[model samples]
Target: MSQPLTGVKVLDFSTLLPGPLCSLLLAEAGAEVIKFERPGQGDEMRSYEPKVDDDSANFVLLNRGKLSVAIDLKSPEALSQLLPLIREADVLIEQFRPGVMDRLGLGYAALAEVNPRLVYCSITGFGQHGPRASEAAHDLNYVAASGMLSLTAGNDGAPVLPPALIADIAGGTYPAMINILLALRQRDQTGRGVHLDVAMADNLFTFQYWGLGNGALGDWPAPASGLVTGGTPRYQVYRTADGAFLAAAPLEDKFWDNFVALVGQDANALAKMSPHRAIEAVAAAIALHPVAYWEDRFAGQDVCTSRVVSLEEARHEPHFQARGLFDRSVTTAAGGTLPALPVPVDAAFRRPDRSAASPALGAHNQLLNR
Candidate 1:
């Protein structure tokens, strides 16, 4: 496909979501992604939720547009084949624990000897230097440790995990992509590669911008109490008559006033009412109408109120569709096409980025030699 990364090569030693997802983006943009796997067992995500003929949708979705290389990292013959391939790689990403790669003699320092221009990326729970870097954790664990978990609430009224893999995919993928790009830019100037030690926990901490700021000011020390959290009634979710949902996030006074007016309530009273009372009023009023009734009433009002759409509904959202969010397609290893989600890129960045199919298991055994 036509893409800016057409000539780029990526060695992905990561499994599951984050690392796979990072390479998937590069591969989509025409980079040749080589996914390394164990001899028999592959990425655990292959059997995770939503199986289609024993292949996980999660795996299929993130792993398209890459080639797979399966070999036992412990085998001398396999190691031999891998070294030469590593020598020619532009970027190398690994999600193993801090010492795993080093034990296998495939660490950043060792690999860089063969390819001085290789960008080596290491993904872990905490970091290469932190005390908790050795701990084993999942998305929720990382979220909890990073303080982002306190920002979320559950139906049971306790801090809970978000439905998505926010820590792994968002934090890890964002760190990988951004640093890789930065390293690529630096390579142009220095003619050498760099190592990126991306701690998923630290990366996930970026979500706590306002809370962190609050802490620095010695105010709002409690989590979820800051302006951007659940502190303002203007930024809360209200229910509709049919038990559907509506969200109002107009933190500004003007939009908050408009939201109250749209609900046929006393705008001034709402602003003055106790948070509990105001939330109750908004909730009660919203329960008086079906989603459609309020949707029409609020239409063209430029209010921040909106229906809380589901994933399926979001897939068909007119706004996103019109904006070409999911406009492109990615070719699959099975010679098929699937919807490609458009990433946010600068409008001034004029580069052709396209999607290709994810690599099948061990699909590139012969293409890359060690």
Candidate 2:
């Protein structure tokens, strides 16, 4: 079957996680993604650690099946070099600071004049014209600014650092992809493209919808006091006897009943007790058994409980293996191959052969002269 975006062309002027990940998804959907990098250095992620084949594994993972074109966007003749690609591109994505593209003469206004049907997406820490638009921030800073960090408190009452780049991937990459796809559909009807200003911090408010709803009703709970945010014993992480953790989230009465029975608790008593005290009691019970014990005990039960496994364990999980989630592999520049990181695109839309590796810096420079 032909991929959905078989003929679409993408001009990617982004770096690191958010923009690269967004373009990765587009590439999986069969868009011809051409990553436009700097003259010598490419995406900063190319220099990140855990190298495979002398290039950063992080870069290869996110940039598989994409072409690379190197050009000094800061040069006097930069626009001339980029005009050909822009004129033929259906989408253009950039992650620069608010005014950087405008100053480079590659802003949406300039590029849209050349290809008015282009869907221009700008992914940033903040929106194009906000007070914090030009502020420098990483994933943690954006989550902090979005109030997501405040809600992830540890047992010591301090906010714990997130294990993943939630703000970058969720706030920026996912939103950029969604908006770009929507804009593309809109373009088919109107024959005109749209500009997407995706602000990572701004998009994070949706993750706090429950808190926002409470705040709107003037009944906002304190940090970590909501049901899903560790307020209730019924939906929280508990430490096991072996120091490993079990994520328990028996939110419904039926599941809570199963969990209470499995843990030797009185469901009625737990239901009536204060939430904090109940949490303590549940934690104590959970601590009586090791993680493996609970994992086996909850195997077929509908209690919504499971052992907290590391990434390595997760990669080898039976459920994920059955789903064939990690079946795709991308080759490296040095002929080594690694598992291609899974994106949300459907398998039917993805390229069947995943042998494509990330391109070398400016690997497609000949396209510029053409």
Candidate 3:
């Protein structure tokens, strides 16, 4: 079957994580994603560490199956060269500050006049016309500004650094793709394109639904003191006897009963204890046994628990292997291939080619001449 975005055309002018990841999803969904990189240097991610060939694995992983057009957007003749592509493009994604694209004469207003049906998407730390629209910030700042960083705390009551770039991917890339798809759908009816203003910091509030609800009712959640946080014995990471961690979340009564019973505690009696006392009790019981013992105990039980595994261990997980999440491959310039980054895009919407490579800088520069 043909992919969902087979006929869509995308012009990606964003680099690094957010915009590139959005366009990567588009490319995987069969959109012809043509990435416009700066001449000579190309994307900054190409220079990042952990190299696969001459370029970083980060760049190739996010940009596979996409075309590249290297051009000097600062040149006087750049607008003329880009006009043809702009006129034929269905979507344009950029990550510059608010007025940067307008200064280059490539903003949504100018391009929409050329192709009225173009969906222009701008991804940034702050949306256009906001108080902090022009602020220079990264993923960490975005998460901190959105009140998400305050919710996670270490044992000493200090906030912990998030393991992943949540704001960049969850707040920026995912929202941009959703809004871009929405804009495309709207364009089919109105025959006119729209501009999408996606702010990474702004989009993060959606992830804190419970926090928002509680805050509005004059009861804000303290750090590590929420239901899904480390507030309850039912939802916590407990250390096993062998120094391994097991993430436990037997939240519901039924699951909690089964969990307490399996942990060799009286479920009814433990349920009556104070939250902290219950937590201490559970922790003590779990500390007597190793991770392997609990893993076997919880294997077929209704308890919602899992032993924490390293990234390397997760790669070899039986469930993920059965799901074929790592089946697709990405080829490097040196002809070495590795498992592709597993994305959330569905199989039916992805390209048929399982093995694909990222473009060399300006590899499709012939399109500029056309």
Candidate 4:
């Protein structure tokens, strides 16, 4: 199979999650991603916990199939060495605060002068020029700023921390990848690159399209009061006898009826009860059975009810295995291997290799000497 990004070259200066993941997708599609890291420490994520050999598991996973070059950008001779690569690079990704790159003489304008067709992408928390651009924040702060956290409330009405870095991946990485592709497309026609400003917080509003619509009509949803949040009995979580939870989302009348029948509850009575009362009744009924019992009862039923499974359980699920989501693996130099982090790229667009290893720190620093 032919990968889409066969000859494309990427200069990855971003650390942590968003930019690294975006480039990982590109690398999977056959791009040559050359990562620039600080000489000694490399990307900060390399020091993160759960080491596989010398690098962190996260670093190993994200930097897979990429080349690494270690150099001190602050050194006077840095730009001279980078200019050769920059002049030929098709893309560059950075996640520094707005002016940090400019100060380091590696901003879009500086690099564009060298390679007019370079797709320079900057991923930031707020944005390049927003009021909060220079302010420090993380994934949680971005979601909170976007009002997404406000919708994720528990029974006590306090916002719960999200399980994953929603803002980092959903808001930053995906958008950066999309826009970089778009910018590359534009370059194909225009013969000139464009600066892409990807603000994680700004992009988060798209995830709240429904909430935005409600807010526009002055019917803004309060904490856990929205349909998908925790509003109706048809869309809530119920705990089982063994302290496990079931995610129930039989919203339509047909599915609700099926769920009611399967749970041995009166559909009409549930419809008559207050939303809170209905939720309580459903919870009480579910509490009568263990997760396995409910899982068996809901099997092959269109009630849209399922037990909340653990990560390990989900990874070992037969459906995902059948789909070959974990068929590919990331191997370490020491020969330890784990399932590659599943990416959104289609199978036809990805490399066919079943296993690949992430680069050791400065493993490809020889490229810089060229």
- Worst lDDT run of 10 residues, candidate 2, spans 219-228
Q: Candidate 2 lDDT, tens digit per residue, 140-213?
A: 99999988898887768799899899989999999999999999999999999989999999999998898999
Give the best candidate by TM-score.
Answer: 3
lDDT of 3 by residue, 29-89 (tens): 9999999999999999999999888789899899989999999899999999999999999
lDDT by residue for model 1 (1-370), tens: 2566778899999998788888877776667888888766678887687764445667777876568888888886766778777877899999998898888888888888888999998877788887887888988899888878766753455886588888887778888888998999999999999999988888876777767777788864343345665656677777888888888887887887787777888977876887767777888888999999988999898788888998999888888789777756655566656676455553233135445555667777886553
lDDT of 1 at 112: 80
lDDT for model 2 comes to 0.90
Query: 2 or 3: which has the higher TM-score?
Result: 3
Candidate 1's clash total is 11
Pairs that collide, model 3: none
Range of the 10 consecutive residues with the lowest summed lDDT in candidate 3: 330-339
lDDT of 4 by residue, 1-370 (tens): 5699999999999999999999999999999999999999999999999999888999889987889899999999999999999989999999999999999999999888889999999999999996899999999999999999988988787899999999999999999999999998999999999999999999999988998999899999887578888878899988999999999999999999999999999999987988889888988999999999999999999999888999999999999999999899998767788779899999989987878888888889899878
Off by over 4 Å in 4: none
C-alpha RMSD of each candidate structure in angstroms? 2.6, 1.1, 1.0, 1.2
Ranking by TM-score: 3, 2, 4, 1
Q: Which residues of candidate 3, in runs, are more than 4 Å off?
A: none
lDDT agreement of model 4 with the native? 0.92
lDDT of 3: 0.93
How does each model score on lDDT? 0.78, 0.90, 0.93, 0.92
